[model samples]
Target chain A: MSRYHTSRSSSTTPVIILYDTPGHSPQPWAPNIWRIRFILNYKRLRYRTQWVEFQDIEATLRSIGAPPSSVRSDGRPVYTLPVIVDPTRNSSRPEIISGPSNIAEYMETFYPARPVFPEGSRAVQSLFVHYIQEVFAKPLLPIMVPLSAKGLPPRSQPPFSHSHAADALPPGPHRERAWQLVKEQFDFLSSILDKNVQDGDGVCVMGHSVSYADFALCSVLLWIENMAPHDGWARIREWNGGRWVRLREKCREYMDVY
Target chain B: MSRYHTSRSSSTTPVIILYDTPGHSPQPWAPNIWRIRFILNYKRLRYRTQWVEFQDIEATLRSIGAPPSSVRSDGRPVYTLPVIVDPTRNSSRPEIISGPSNIAEYMETFYPARPVFPEGSRAVQSLFVHYIQEVFAKPLLPIMVPLSAKGLPPRSQPPFSHSHAADALPPGPHRERAWQLVKEQFDFLSSILDKNVQDGDGVCVMGHSVSYADFALCSVLLWIENMAPHDGWARIREWNGGRWVRLREKCREYMDVY
Candidate 1:
């Protein structure tokens, strides 16, 4: 089944355009994009995905006049996917929001209901998101990046190939060491989530409700399941006494492809 | 002047006994104990401080049958302060709660009003508290530990002396590097708190209200101010556009000393 169906009619609510990268499957697979996708689905906003190839990201985003997400060390603007053009405010000239957190903040400002950052939790939630990105996702780059790059088209494989060559570890002691570091990070996160079990059965990063912190983590879990289903996903699904699996189950409602 | 007084009469509400270490001043300066003090003052719980010398911490806690906070590397029990004996549940044989987070959880459980972990935020709040303790406080030990040991009575200074000798950095490039790392951690935290400015002017770690996360951080600020008012506190108070000073001001009501 195609994952490109529109949620609402164009005459009523103008759909937001999400620039995403395509994967082997019909569903979107990028972790950062998944974060925004979770928010978009959770908010029940009318939106459509614009699949941009990895090579065409810079040109496509630049053509749309979307600002650079960050600056490169060598004084060049770095353009990445997961940029959104929201036409709800002004259907003629929509607002372009780049970066995952920036787009999440914009959505919170415009859609005010079913908030991702509930009850002024934007600050601490951002910290949690940052921790996942830095401490959790960073170590997995060696293992996941190469596995992820394998699925990309030949034309879109150059950018990731450089890091994949330098950082990728074969099945050996080094790979085991890499997995150990990732496990330690997971253990730290699991300890934090253990505190919430007393409140209820829900395994969200926040209180009992599903917030952006849960989405931030679940996005990575989705990435792992997509890239390394047999080895990575198999082991991670059972880690910390199946806490990650429970968390992913709790976030299953917001896992809509479109 | 003594910083030792009962909040409520012994007949009405049996006062909670807070085990704390003393500094040069009458006010209790230990960071972990200050966390409980903040919660107690915020909840308006009747409690009194029981000063314990560092040398007598193990014996004092063991005599009252308090459980060890943690196990040391060599398998012996590691006893620390911030142990509380709450008499509200049973006046004759009060319950002892050790460890900062444990005591905070106990307070949130029994005295649910004006909750420190508001709205089921125990999990994410624990992550924030853990970040402060590990990332923020760990680096400051080189600078703050020796300075703090100076304020302790000669009889209570042995335990800290070993670490002070090994970890204390002199006023040179080594100390500057340590401060730089500390500044980077603060910058990261300030960026997190910066998100809450959109909601209001409050400089809390969580929402507009002061939660346990703020107390966890402010407790460190109190330790720094008590130990290194001239240099360490002075520099930190001015960093991040005076955010720390603003946070301290917001927490002024709960820093009742008694």
Candidate 2:
């Protein structure tokens, strides 16, 4: 496994453990988890990855007393990965943070240098991230979720396959419509990026520097590249005048898998 | 009519004319037009209002040699209001700029002192505005369109009344569902604003300073208040812990009616 040492001067050992679920591929693939990974790498924080199987996610999170990320329809708690355990804050007791937003906030508070949210941009950046997930990514779920499930390891495949059975769109009009919706979202985002063309490459969402919004977007691109590199990534890379390809390249430095 | 003069030192007279449609109420009611009005007032640009009837919008625009904002499906050009004619750009030939985005950009380019897009924020701010219009204001359209049509002047009433006839949502479950969707959007926006609570009142979409995003949102709030004051604005003002009320108050300075 690849590891990154802390660049910051710290007397103690770097013990920030990021809990992630492994896919079939050697590299990490989940978009939500990739958000934190991007932030960790961007901040150049020293952290280690603890891979847990999808089946063991609940038990693993419960053992560490991390709160449930969400609740299922049946009123049961639904545990999710991308939880971080940071002993740097307190050596005796590591702070366990669940949920991507919470973890991001914790990291930003602890590691102030190279902030993910630039000056006075937390609210707007959060809105951008919300738009990416709720509007942009919502249309892609039916197409991507099933593809993503198929890319998981055999032990982790059963749960995702069963849960996302209804999410599969057969290769026909329905799937085409799904892809068309994804394209429209991409077009809208591309237009937003176009405004920044005068400044530079128009890769990062905010200004010239990389922010959480870029990480949030690039994480999805990474997911698409990881899961459906042949079809999905091929189409997306060419869309919006190759904006996504440039964005992925712009964010390539932070994609160090650990 | 209320008139605002330029605070800047200009030897020549202010000759910026904004084309807008007037409602039955003395105040301006159109949300799209309000966006420009907010910018003009915020920038403190000296401008005159040329009230255009809804039916006269096309003829008025055509008279000024302004291009059509869009084309109807039947191949006919569709003209819209909130077009600005600035003689300051050229003495012999005035520059007639249509569309809110274009007008805002023009204003920012010329009047760079008080920028609506604060430092490399043009792209993300535009995305915020897009989200407000395409997503947040969409469900409110079916509910607000018919109500807005009723509030227009008699000459302007016919076109809106007929055009939005099918957009009316009667008092029933469907209307309730529309409001619920609006509430959900408001909730999402409120959460974004909540991130700024520690900073201040959490009124502005950005930091403490008001920007174009605030104008876009406040324009919608003004629409609800103007069209459906009792039911729509009443409910919205109370929702999300009086967030909309605070935003409207925050932007009240820019709500000049001229």
lDDT of 2 by residue, A127-221 (tens): 88988998889888888888877887887776765574536677788878888999999998888888866553577888898899999999999
Q: Which regions of candidate 2 are displaced past 4 Å?
A: A1-14, A163-180, A199-201, B1-14, B163-180, B198-201
- Computed on alpha carbons, the lDDT of every model, listed in order, comes to 0.84, 0.84
Best by DockQ: 1
- TM-score of each candidate structure, all chains considered together: 0.91, 0.90
For model 1, what is the alpha-carbon lDDT of residue A57? Answer: 94
Give lDDT for model 1.
Answer: 0.84
| Residue B147, model 2: Cα distance from true site in angstroms | 1.7
Clashing pairs for predicted structure model 1, backbone only: none
What CA RMSD would candidate 1 show?
Answer: 2.8
Candidate 2 local lDDT, B184-240, one digit each (tens): 989988888887665445788878889999999999998899889987998898898
Instruction: Write one digit per residue (lDDT tens) for candidate 1, span B150-225.
Output: 7888888788777644356768998889889889888888888888877746598776889899999998998988
Q: What is the TM-score of chain A alone in each candidate?
A: 0.93, 0.91
